[model samples]
Target: MNQTKKYLVVGLGRSGVSAAEALLRYGAEVSVYDKKTQDEIEAPLVNYLKTQQVTCYLGTDPSDLGRYDAIVVSPGVPLDLPFLQKAKTLDVEIIGELELAYRLGKGNYIAITGTNGKTTTTTLVGEIFKNAKRKTAVVGNIGIAVTSTALVAQDDSWLVTECSSFQLETTEKFHPVVCALLNITPDHLDRHKTLENYAKAKAKVFKNQTEKDFFVVNYDDPVAYHLIQECRSTIIPFSRKSILEKGVFVKDNRIIVKDQSQNEIDICGVDELVIPGQHNLENALAACGIAYFCGISAEMISKTLREFQGVEHRLEFCAEVGGVRFVNDSKGTNPDASIKAIEAMKGNIVLIAGGYDKNSKFDEFIQAFDGKVKALVLLGATAPKIRETAERFGYQTIFDEKDMGECVKRSFSLAEPGDTVLLSPACASWDMYSSYEQRGKHFKSCVQELER
Candidate 1:
C-alpha cells in the first residue's frame, strides 16, 4: 500500500469498486471509470464513491491516463481496447483485480480455474475446508470479488477462489498455495482472439507458484494435462478415465487418492457423489485432489462431496409442473459447459439456449443435443448464429425469443408432460442479463409463474 501511488480502476463492476475502495484506504488517489453512465451504474454507488473523495469517470472514456501509477482492470473489461492500449504505450502498468488483490491481501489462496466446473469445484472445496474447520472465504469469479475478501484476509486465511481466463490475464505475482486447472476448453475467444491465447491466460493461475506449492489438474482433459509440462509446482493430477499412480482418481467405483509415497486413501464411491454427469465426477476428483493436498481428511472430503447438491444454476432442478420438470443450468455459459448440462439431463428436453456471442462455434453444442433436445428455444445475440448451426446439423426444431422469461415460456410450451425444460444457454448471459445468476433467477421466476 503506497500512499504516494495513484490508481485508475477500470469498469464499474464489483471488482472495480473494491479495487478503488481498497486503494483509497491505502491513502492512494483512486479514480473509477465505467462506460455505463451514473444512472445505469445506479446513483447510490456513484454517490458513495464521490463522498469518499474518489474521482469517477462514467458514461464516457476519460482522456487523461498517464498520471495514474497503474490501471486496475475488472475482468469484464478487455485489455486490448484502445483506451487500455493507450495506457500501455504511455508506460503505465496495467493489472487486473486479481493482481491488485494479491498485492494488497494476505492469505493462503486455493485457486480453481477452467472453462467449466469452476463454481462446483471451488464451492465443494470450500465446503470440504469448512468441514475441516479452517478459516475460509470462497471468492473470485464465482461472484464475490476476491479483493473484497482479500483486503481483510489474514495470512493464514484460506481464500478458496474460482478464477477465469480474463481475471488471470493481468496477474503478475498472484500465486496460490494450491492451484487447480479443472479443464481448458475453448471459451471467450472473442476477447482472447484464439484458443491458445485463452489457455495461456488460464495457465497464469500457477505461473508464480513455488516448488512447495501444489498444482492440481485434470489429467483426463488433454489440454489441462498438457499444461503440466511447464508447471514448476508439485503436480496433483485428477482423472476420471485413468487411475493415477500418485494423485486423485476412481478405482473400482470409488474415489481414491495416492500420495507421493505410494500410500493410497479411499475417499468414497463414485455413486456417493450427489452431483450427476461425468463432468461432475471430474469436478469431484479435482475437489478431492485439492482437499487431500491441503491436508483435509478423507472422511471430511467424502462427506462433503456426497452432501453437495451442486451449485445453483448448474443443472439445478426448479420444479415439476404438469409433470414437466424444469432444470436451470444458466451457468452453462459456453458450448462445452452446455454440453455437460445436456449429458447430465434425463428424458427429452425442451432446451433453452443462446446468449451473448463469444465468437464460439456451436457445431459440437448442437451435436450434443443428440435427439435428446426436442426443441431449442434461443435468445440473446447468438440466437441466429446457433440456429444456423442447428440447421447445418440437420436439426430443425428451433424457436427464438427476445429474453429469458419468454424463452422459458417457449421452452415449457414446447415440452411434453414427461419432458424436461432445461435452461442451459450455450453462451454468456451478458447480451440479455448482466450475469448468468440474474439470467438463472429470471428463468426460475418465469417458471414459477407458469400455471399447472
Candidate 2:
C-alpha cells in the first residue's frame, strides 16, 4: 500500500473505524463518513478520530469521492447506495474492511464463512494454532475487526477470520491460504435478495486462492458441496455422515482424517468434545481438516477439541434455575442456526424465539420442533408471524411476550423440572438489542436473577 494514498472510509461502525485507524497508521490520509450524526456516534470513537486527524463527515454522504485513491466500505453499508454508485462512476476503488486488512496485513489467513457456525469453527481453528504455539488472531464477524491486528501481523502469524456474506460481497483480492465454508442456508435474504446472490458472495473467500491454497467445505451441506466446482484451491471436505476417501469424517465414534496417502488417522472420539450438538461435531471436523493441513498435530487438535467448551451466545448454558436449564443461543439469529440449537437440546424445551423478521419463513424451524419443543415463547417484531406459522403446523402451545424479561419468565413457566429453557431467537437481535452479544448477556442476567 502506498503511504501517500488517501482513503475514504464510509461507515463509522467498528470495522470502518478500525480501517481508518489502520490507514492512518500506514501513513495515509483518511476521511471517515457515517450516515449517523456526530451526536449519535460514540464519544470515544469521535475523540479518537479527531486525535488521529481524520476528516469526519457525519449524518450525510460526502459530496465527492473522486479525491480519495480508494473507498473502504464497512460491512453494514449497502453497495447499491447512490454515493457508492457514484464512486463506481468515478472509477474509485471500492473495497470492504476485510479487503483493506488483507492489502495491508502480512500473514497467512484461514477464513471461515457460512450462514452459521463460522464463529465456533474460526475460534476452534485459532485455538488449535495457539495450542501449537503459533501466533494467531481471531477476527472479523466474531467481534474484533481484522484491521485491528492486521498491521501487527507477522509472516508466520495465522489469522483465523470469520468472514460474513456482507464482508465477502465487497472483497476483490482478499485471499486466504486456507478457507472453510461450514454450511450455506437461507439467510440475509433481506440484503442479498436471493440465495444465489448470497452464495456467490460467500464464494468470494476462495476467489483469489491458487491451487496451493486449501478450501475446507462441508460435504453434508449441498450448497457448500456444490461450490467446490468453482474453487481453484485444493478442496478438502468434512462430513458428519459418510466416510470420505480423502477428507475428514466421523467413523466408529471417532473423528477420522484421510491423508493424501489414503491413510486413516484418528484424532479423537466424538465423546471427547466439550461442545454439544451434531453441528459442533461438523465444526470440529472442519477444524481438524484445517489444523491437519496447517501442520498442526492430531494431539493438539484433539486437546483443543476436548477443552473447548464453545463460543459465547451459541448454546452457552446460563444457569439452572428451579431444576430447569437456561441455555442462551442468542447467536442463533437465523432459522438454520436455531434448528441446530433445537436439535442439540436433550430434554423437553421451552423455546424463547423470534426477533427482527428477515423475511425468513418459520416452516422449517417449526418442523424441526419435533415434539421436543414443549412450548414456543415468541417475542420481538416477528412474534405474530412465528405464532401464525406455528398454528399452521398444528402447534397450539405458543406464547408471545413483548420483552426479553417477560419472554424468559414465560419460557421458565412453560418448562418442567427436567426441561430446558432455550433462548434461541430464530431472527436477528436488531429489533430489541444492538447485537446478539448484548441480547445474550441480558438473557443470562435475567436467568441469573431467577429465585432459587
Candidate 3:
C-alpha cells in the first residue's frame, strides 16, 4: 500500500468536496472542515461523505491547522483568512482544488481566464478539441474540481480549465501549455477589494508560464490587451476589431487565424456562428486560436462554431409570448456583464436587474442603459441601490417585488409586443435564489406560466 498521508480539506462546496474525495481515492486520510454545520450542507453530499468515512469538522473553529500535510482549499475560502494565515505560518502548503488536479492529471492543459466569457471560451475550446477527436475534459471554476478529475485522468489528454480569480489566487507551479486571458473588467470587487486587485488576480494565470507555453489574449479589451506586453510566453492574440499580426481576427466576413510567421488559415465566416453577441464572437475567435495551438483542424472549429447552441443563462431565449421575447441572462452577475447584455438587444428592453450588490460601481451600466432599456425593474437585496443609481442617472426605475416571478410579471406588464423582457441582474443571486441557475429557472417558469 502507498504510505497513507493525512490531508485537510477546507470548505465543503463543490470544489472542496471534490478535492476531499480525490484525496480519499488516493489512499490518503482525509479530514474535511466547512464553516457551515453538518446540517447546513447539502444533505446528499454530507451523507455521501459520511459513507466515504472521511473525518468531518462541521461548525467548528478552523484553528486546528497543525494536523495535516497539506490544506486543500475551495475557491470560496479566502487566502487571507485568520486560520489560513496561521496554517501558512505553520508551514502547511496551501493549494486549491485546481492545483491539486493539475498535479495529478496526465494531460497537457489549456487554461482560460477572464472577467467574462471564460465559461463559453473554455467550453468552446474543449468542444473544438473534442470535435477533432482529441481526448479532452473541460473543468475548473465552472464545475467539477480540476484536481479531482486530474487524479483519475492521464496527463497526456487535454485539460481545458475555466480558471477564476479565486482559483488563481492560490496557484503556484500549475502551468498550462495554452493559456488565455479573455478580458478584464471590474468584477468580484467585494472579494478582491478593488478593481486593480481583481485585475491583478486574473493576470496571475500566466504568472509561472514558460517560453514553450502560449499566452493568447484579447487585444481589444484595454486592460487585458495592454497586459500582453508583460507576459513571458509566446503571445497569440484574437480580436473582433483590431488586426493581429498573429492569431485570429475577422476580416471581410471571414474568421482568420494567422501563425507566428503571419501565415493565415480561414476558419469560418463571421455570420456562421450560432451564438449571437459581440463578446461571444470574440470568444469564438479566442477559442479558435486555442484550437489552432492544440492542433485542432480548421474544419472542426468551423463545424463546432456553427453548431454550438451556447451556454445557458447567457442571453438564453426563454420564450416569445405575444410578440415579447423573454431572455434569461441571470449569469450577468456584474455591471459590465449586464451592460453587455443590454447592448446586445435590438429594440427597446424591459430590463429586470439587481441582486446581491458585490460592491459594484454602477456608472458603466448607467452609461450603457442610456436609451437601450425602455424601463428597469429592480429586485433582490441590491434593488434599492440599483434604483438609487438609475434615478441618479436620470432614468425611470421601478422598485418592484421580492422574487424573479413578480419581476417577470411586472416586466411583461411594462413591455409591448416588440419589446423584450430581459432578466440580466447585474449582481450575485445569493440574496434571493440559491444560484444563478435557480434564478434563471424561475424566470423560465414564470415565462412558461405566462405562456399558458
**What are the per-model C-alpha RMSD values against the true structure?**
1.3, 1.1, 1.7
Q: Give the TM-score of candidate 3.
A: 0.96
- TM-score of each model, paired residue for residue: 0.97, 0.98, 0.96
Global lDDT for candidate 2? 0.92
Best by TM-score: 2
Clashing pairs in 1: none
Better of 1 and 3 by lDDT: 1
Better structure of 1 and 2 per lDDT: 2
Q: Cα miss at 387, model 1 (Å)?
A: 1.4
Tens-digit per-residue lDDT, 1-452, candidate 3: 24387788989888887888778778888888888997788888888888888888898855568877889888988778788889888999898888877765567878899988988898888888888888788889777678766776764678899999999987887888889999999888888998788878888788888888899999888898788767899888899997778889998889999997778899888888888889889899999988898778888889999999888899999999999999989999898888888888889999999898799988778779868788888888888888887788788756578777888889999899999999999898988887888888988999999988
Please list the C-alpha lDDT of all candidates, in the order they appear: 0.91, 0.92, 0.85
By the TM-score metric, which is better: model 1 or model 3?
1
